[model samples]
Target: MTEQLLSIHELTKSIGSIMPVKGISFELKRGGCTALLGPNGAGKTTTLRMLAGLIPPTRGEIRYGSGDGHTDSWRHRIGYLPQYPKFYSWMSGMEYLSFSAKLSGLSGKEALRRSREVIEMVGLQQAAKRRISGYSGGMKQRLGIAQALVHEPELIMLDEPVSALDPIGRREVMDLLDRLRGEVTVLFSTHVLHDAEEICDDMILMVDGEIAEKGALSELRTKYRQPVLSIDVEPGEREVAWLDSLANRPYVQEIELGKRGAKLMVTDMGVARAALIQELADAEIQLLRFEAGTSTLEDMFMKVVGS
Candidate 1:
């Protein structure tokens, strides 16, 4: 079994009348990448803030290391980057990283050494001497990641790290994160399911301040996998009537219809596929496209969040 790096139990946070996190519990394995996934207003940021020690939880326990005991000393073993990080515009990337390293408790010389090392690790060495104000959005985010790594913490927590980047910027950060896997324990939050799917091994899905689903990504995919069929036909009286009749079919569990097509949730793919093709052939329907497949993580995400 893998070693456990962090364990949270019944962690709750309340701000007067609003409770952003409600008794959430999960564990992170050492050297594993986990995604705290949820839609907006789902308490992902609040949970991360509490774990980062930026705010006090109203109740529950946070434990680090292999021991059952809890302590505040784990702060030094972890680094955090918020969703929206602010930097000193006048400072160069190297200057900013060195300053941050010193603040994290390294000597001046060591700070400079680590700063240069991390800047290079993040692929910002070319722009290390450039003022932060002139850096593009992707560059700034990479710099932010560099600061988080300057102290060489065993674990790093990033809140919505790529949520605001353009396609190119998002790709850059995602690639950087992919490279960081196994080098350090990572826990990042994001609402974009594809981003989470692209990199994370484990997932803790939050909904309205509660964990709607939590498990290994592959396991969740297996547990929630369902048969689905997509059918598109040239719009006409016959096609429209045949499409409308599908919802009542015993093999179809559910359906979503469009002007030219219908997406079907089926009980069995083989039966549904054979039956649909035959129906189209018999009806002489003008079929444009037909596809059969299993549901994906996005399907489960929508089911959990929509509920």
Candidate 2:
């Protein structure tokens, strides 16, 4: 059996009149990459902050380590990067990391060694000596990650690491995260399902401060996979009526109608596809696009968050 790295039980946080996190519970396995997924205002940041020991939970327990033994000094065993990381702009990348390492309790000599090692690990070796003010958004984010890793903690928690990056910067950070997998236990929070799907093996989805779903990514995908059909036709009176009429079909379990198209959750892809193609041919409708496939993680994400 895999070792349990962390176990959180009924964790709740309340600030005055509002409760952002409401008794959430979950566990992380050693060396696993797990994503904490939810939309904005879903308490993901608050939950992560609580886990990182930056804020005290209003109630509940957080246990760290394998077996029956747990530690209150779990802070040193985990590293955290906030959603918005602050930096001393005057400091060089190397200086920043070394400072962070030392603050995490490393000696000066060891801090310098770890800083150099992690700067290279995050592909910031070329910018190591350059002032942080000159670093690009991606570079700064990478620097944030490096500082999180400088102490070689058993676990690292990142809060929406790529939410602010441009396409190029997002790709850079994503690739770095992919490389870091299996080397450390990662628990990162993000609203984007695509990012979570790309790198995480497990996921815990929070909606309005509660765990709506939690499981291995593959298992969740398999559980939620369902036949779906998308159809688009050139707009005309007949085409518009026909698209709307798809909801009345017995095979279509659910339908979302648009001006030029409809997305259908169908009971049987084969029956639905054949029937739709035949109807289009018979009516001489100008087809723009038609697709038949299983629903994706995004579909599942929308369903959970929308509810």
Candidate 3:
């Protein structure tokens, strides 16, 4: 029970000429849920696997707890679920959890008891007896979580846990993770910024296999926060051209264009707003929608990655 559950220092993973994770470093707090935020191929999975002892890093160290930073003797304290968790299609959920429990060093009786308990904790009790082949995608993900938790590890690391699931399935897993927060120090990787913002107080943002930003969610939000204007016009050549011209406006800092709309990052919201409205009126462009708001967490994510 140290306050720091884990600390990664100058962690580097190199493969020949390609470096998947380059000198990344961060710390995870005890009993805190942290999101490894990044897009595809950002080395998120690699980082998680390395931390989970699936692979050794090319350079750097991972210190578990406040101990002497020993690498060995820390596996039992961790639980991991990969993005695509594999399981025997014929095995029932209960069987899989029990097997995993035993693999984690629990005795037969302990394994069974833990399996039953975790099955109920993840809301898989109803489907615990059913074959894996018959369970839905969401149920299977829950079972994967159950297996991970069966050993009652101190920290759980999940790699892109919800990326493969449908909306409903994703919500189910997210909700479960939210509930598990504070109970177990959770570290989950996800490219979806909104998901991280929703449940995690801390985040490690990655881009191109390197750390882009890492901090408490509130701090990062304020650090990247800015005035934003989202505008949508009817899909027509004239309207599209009008939107394109706004990119060169003096007050606009950046612009992300979409099919029917564009989100503009502005230095001065009031000036840009009045000018943009005048330009639209003068051109008689068909305005479909308009909004004034601050940069969202997703916007900040894109900006950091892009930077």
What's the TM-score of each model vs. the native?
Answer: 0.87, 0.86, 0.83
Q: In terms of TM-score, how similar is model 3 to the real structure?
A: 0.83
Model 1 agreement with the true structure over 1-307: per-residue lDDT tens digits = 9999999999999999999999999999999999999999999999999998999999999999788645467777889999999999999999999999999999999999999899999999999999999998888999999999999998999999999999989999999999999999999999988888999999999999999999999999888788999999998999999999999999999898999999999999999999889999999999999999888888878877877
Displacement of the residue 40 alpha carbon in candidate 2, Å: 1.4
Q: Write one digit per residue (lDDT tens) for candidate 3, span 140-223.
A: 888888878888999999888888899999999999999999999999999888899889999998999899889999998887
Checking candidate 3 for backbone clashes, the offending pairs are none
Compare the candidates by TM-score and give the number of the best one.
Answer: 1
The TM-score between candidate 1 and the true structure equals: 0.87
lDDT of 2: 0.93
Per-residue lDDT, model 2, residue 40, is 94
How do the candidates rank by lDDT, highest first? 2, 1, 3
Please report, in order, the local distance difference test score of every candidate based on alpha carbons: 0.93, 0.93, 0.90
Q: Pick out the ten consecutive residues of candidate 3 with the lowest summed lDDT.
A: 298-307
